[model samples]
Target: MGLFGPSEQEIETAVNAALDKRASIENPSVPLSSQNVLSFLGLDATSSAGERVTIESALGVPAIWAAVNFLSGTLASLPLHLYKRGKSGRERDTSALGVILHDAANDETSSFAWRKYIFDQVFTGGRGVTFIERSAGKKVINLWPLNPDCLTIKRIDGRKVYQYKDGKRTVTYEASEVIDIPFMLKRDMLSHYSPILSNREAIGLAQAVTKYGAKFFEGGGVPPFAIEGPFQSPGGMQRAADDMDTAVRKASKEKRLALSLPAGHKIHQLGVDPEKSQLVELQRFIIEQVARIYSLPPIFLQDLTRGTYSNTEQQDLHLVKHTLRRWLTQFEQELNLKLFGRASARQYVEANVDGLLRGDFKTRMEGYARAIQTAQMTPDEARDMENRPAKGGEADMLHIQGATVPLGSQPIRGIGDNGGPPLNDEGNNSNAA
Candidate 1:
């Protein structure tokens, strides 16, 4: 310790040390040395999830892409609707909410774009974030999807808040103002589960396999000649041998399979084909594993190794029932919570999965026929689903083809009979007559 404050150098060092400590305490940083492992994903040392899975690793790997793409693409293609339930318990399309949610930004982004963004975020990071621009009454007016990685969640004074770091300054948003849809990552109500972080091993193996493949192909093939018997090589001799190897490679690339080797070297084939290495099987097995992790059908990820003619329809059903259904349900519940306040539960959001469940032409027609016959759906309803215009009077009407009559009475045979008499063939007869 120095009297009358420390020396200039000491003061500078102390201040610098203090600042470094304070900076670390204020804003934690991901270290640079922990940046890359496979030249793709980085396992950060300062992550709350205890592991940082890089986007490059997730997107760089094929299996991961197959799963993520299928999810994002499917969600974007589906039609989502907003419905309002009145006091009478009747629900109808709530267009006002629908307009905003469909586009979210109400500008350049499409409804599919909004859904795709949300779907991708949810599946990959297990958290989908959006900033809700609210009216004076706190009703949501505009919505913008925020980068989940940049968001920091907090709970203050029994109220949850989000601190959005943009550039230098931080912006705090109330829980109500931010749509924080988090999947159950670790029972922490705020932070979410990251699929990439959890499935690092599988993804890493995939990366390794992909790299091995690339490396193998990049080398063209194994060296065609192996040095046999006693041989000695000084610097000049080694250089010549390397030149010979380069020449052999050049020849192999030019489709000249025949190679002239030096006297001491004979052509020794080292054959380990992809089939023998079980790479095809490994690729397929990895695909299935990824599918299971995402609760997706292997067929959905373009894995047709196990697909069959009869099981195709069943696979479609499985996709809707198991995979998309769960995701849609989560979306519905999350939208309900975020868009509609928890206090007053009048309106909720729903995705029209019926469109996804529609089978092929014949199957669809049969199902529609049954629905129409059972009075479960009107002719117009069925036709509307098929994108066809209404056919007129009977198309709008609901019919039950029981061929029975009114209570305590029988169905009249013709227009003349009023629950009394049957008409003679082509002739009108009635009790009223």
Candidate 2:
């Protein structure tokens, strides 16, 4: 029992404190906050959390919101399963690590809730942190996600520790207890560069241009008015100019269709051509630029300027293979390393990208038909892929069109009905003239 209390929790805490004191004294706390992290690191203070490229700022930009939403939403939609190595090469879903990852809900949050949160943070901040709470025998029972920005990684001597800063107090965690997933490695291999930070200048340009457009439309894109009337004295001319300016502004504010001018004064029209301004084309180019920053196809960003029927499918393939593939691979590797121990080679995580790869109904059906006819899979398996319940009797059997015993059982038949070898490129058979 602890000196201060008879409770087990208090006793445990006291014992941990003694042990920690004996090992290595805790370092003096260095205060941190989401707003000052960048400043602490000698970076531009304007780039700190809630300042530049923040979740709010990101969502405020339509292009950024669409890119991040598409990426994170797609990840959260996949069903993660816990799998184990069975006899031979077959696998089954029953591992403890898999169970923890497949549904990471604790007493506080649901699987979907934390999964979406994790992906959103990972893509935005290029990092995600989850603290592990283990039961007896070191079995993980609950995991809690922490704000990536508030959490900092620091190495002391040879050991690494994680610090979660809340105001002036920082709580420390050993590296082994926190699952830190980095989107991509930086120079030191411990930190990552945020995508939003790298693209801040471009995003700022887009925002500036948008604001300019808004103000331009507010004035109806009209230019300042000019006058050609004469006044006798300098003061008289100034007063006349002021009177004319006030009258024009009041007329515009009241939305009057007509304005009165003196007999000698004439209204000069200031003209602007929308085409010469290149506003539409400039906006289109900027949207395309934003899409390229995230490696997203222009179509995904709703920029369909260059879209064509012939190239649409190709673009889809490009996104799946080049863009999504890279992100998914990183996620899978991190999951495999953290959830399943590094030593467990055969048991690893994989995403079913077939959802993105699925073609039109006819094409998909034809491909499945080929698989079934070649004994690659049963008809029930094909149906199961389309989320249809398997028929208990007929669909279980594998069949081929060759009138054979089992698939590939009979030798490939001769080329033709002549019961002879096939003709060569020279149009002559070896056995016949």
Candidate 3:
């Protein structure tokens, strides 16, 4: 049958087969690579069960169900461990360290110095498209992304206006109000480079606005720069290019090594960890394979990257590959221990463990299915009526009396003569009921 969806048992059996293969190959002296583990199960490394049309998930949908079941199961086990630790008069500890570095060569600083450093130097700031508008008060104005072609300026008060610029940025100011001049650049220019700018550098290029500030305010002037940095630089534009070069060099060196090395070492040497690489490579392989089958990334990576600045599509893929590789490594280690007679008692420990240890995916899936089926059925008497129907022509009609009807029941009508019930002929309307 097509592998789009497989029965729970079928999924279980396939997973069991993969586990058996893992036991066999790992049981011997030979170590297993991530690639080897995939090959043994005839699995494409990149795809999830959801994507692949062929090659069923050996672990099955129930297994996936079990994985989710264990999600809370695993988390629930944590409190007890913490409690045990608390009894021992010990507690988990965490720490954070930070250092501020000044760009002495820039010769400028400001109150929000740190912001400049982070956005420009660290993030490699570049130009971006933003909208600018005057508030309803007319005294206040805002700068945001500007539409590239239409140049539509949407005010905070929900009014939209079209603005025209003749290759020049226009920063309008009220007669009494003061505002900072905006630096505008083409949208395409921002996309051409990274999106970080250093405050110190921008400050160095900034000119003092003494006349305007002195005229409007009692203060002498706003400083030449109000931001501090390691400023934006043309040199930093090559950051991505430099990163690519380093990656290429690393790859070339790793490829020159022998393939028989331990998988962990191989991955590490390539500047990646066995437990946390992206699945892009694996996915590519799977696409080349049977052109189907998909898998989720590991739990830890998903947890780490969820809803954060560090989270990205690339990061997600990295975590998936990393976790899968790590699992494969662990499997290989277990097998080696078995072969060497080092872990005789612990052999098959993973498989032997109950749902509490392995995962509770199956229980949850069945529970969910039951819940869904129940939800689809009508409640109370409606459900009962659907299960039972009276005899005769009326039985075909699902609706009875004034109520609507029930599931699985057909509709019917009673008529006289030809296609109707036998009509009474004793002075009763023969053709009418």
**Could you give candidate 2's per-residue lDDT for residues 1-433 as a string of tens digits?**
3222222223333444545555654633433233343443334324322245444666676777888888788776676665566676657566665666666557787666766788788767778778888889876688788887677665679787887876789889987677777776666555676777666767666665565577665554545556667667888778876887677667668877576777787767555544566768877877887888778888888877799987888999998889878877776776666655678866766667787777899998999888877777788889988999999565776767555234544444345546555555565764575
lDDT of 3 by residue, 1-433 (tens): 1233332223334565655665694565434334444444454333322222121222122322233333223322221110112454444222110011111211243212322322222112222132223458531133232223322222325432334242567443221221111122234221122211212221111111112223323322111212122425756435633543455456555554222321222222233331244333442332222111113433321333234644554544553354334433343343233222353432221211122222246754454344334444223323233354435343333342223443344233335335453345463445574
Q: Each candidate: how many clashes?
A: 0, 0, 47
What is the lDDT of every predicted structure here?
0.69, 0.68, 0.30
What is the lDDT for 184 in model 1? Answer: 53
lDDT of 1 by residue, 1-433 (tens): 3333222234334444555654685655523232332222222322342333455666777878878888888977787777777876647565666776654454666778877887788777778788888789867767788887667775699888888877688899988777666645454465556777567777666666676677666656652344443346576556756876787678768967676656766545565666687987887888877887888878888888778987877888888888788777877787788777787566777777788888779989999877776667788889989899988666766665554222224344776556556765656564444
Candidate 1 lDDT score at position 361: 90
Which pairs of residues have clashing backbones in candidate 1?
Answer: none
Those runs of model 2 whose alpha carbons end farther than 4 Å from true positions after fitting are: 1-42, 45-55, 94-100, 166-169, 221-275, 392-394, 404-433
Residue-level error in angstroms, candidate 3, position 402: 16
Weakest 10 consecutive residues of candidate 2 by summed lDDT? 2-11
The superposed Cα distance between candidate 2 and the true structure at residue 192, in angstroms, equals: 2.5
Candidate 3 — what's its lDDT?
0.30
